[model samples]
Target: MLARVRRNGGTAEEFIGRSGPGVQARVPVVTSEGANKVQDVRFVGLDGPGWLLRGTITGTGAVPGSTDAWSCGMRLVGR
Candidate 1:
């Protein structure tokens, strides 16, 4: 799973939130000038029988821009 949060400092500004899911053995983060940033998310899940992966993203704010997104995926190695 991977998630991110971003906010703008103005009233009329905006905030965004994102999330997703995947099979990953490791997550990497990079830092520079005392700030941490996400480098990347690597998916390492192997394809096998009944393997499933899913993800969802949601956001809310004062404005009507709030929304949500969902997705699902699966694999059947042998059926």
Candidate 2:
């Protein structure tokens, strides 16, 4: 999954949060004010019998060390 991002000219770093192993990256965003911003995002995948669950963390939840990220990750990965 992360390989696909790097192949497309983006950066993907591995991280272990409450969600366990996942990929993190900084993505460019255009805000409501029409200003450019670099936002932190995370992608996590869970696999189950012939199925996959993908979750994304964006905005405040994407900030490193933020409790929001931890909580969200827990909910996503713990299930």
Candidate 3:
């Protein structure tokens, strides 16, 4: 996954969140001109018997001031 991001000129950080069933990854985009930009994305996945369910949070919900991402992640894992 990280490799995929790098292939497109972006960087990713994978981390384990406190309550999710799987690891969460954040891909922050690097502006070629000068500024560092954060991508509003949180990918949460749950490994199942024969499949995996993945969820993504974007927009303001993926930023520091929102709980929508966490809530959605929990819902995905809980399923």
The TM-score of predicted model 2 comes to: 0.68
Put down candidate 3 lDDT per residue, 1-79, tens digits, no spaces.
6677667665556656633643233466677897777675655677779987777766765554355644444744355
- The parts of candidate 1 lying over 4 Å away from their true place are 2-33, 49-79
lDDT of each: 0.29, 0.74, 0.59
Distance from true location, Cα of 77 in model 2, Å? 9.6
How well does each candidate superpose onto the true structure, as a TM-score? 0.20, 0.68, 0.57
Ranking by TM-score: 2, 3, 1
TM-score of 3: 0.57
Q: How accurate is candidate 2 locally (lDDT)?
A: 0.74
The total of clashing pairs for model 1 equals 0
TM-score of 1: 0.20
Clashing pairs in 3: none
lDDT of 1 by residue, 7-26 (tens): 22111212233322232212
> Considering only N, C-alpha and C atoms within 3 Å, which residue pairs clash in candidate 2?
none
Most lDDT-accurate candidate:
2
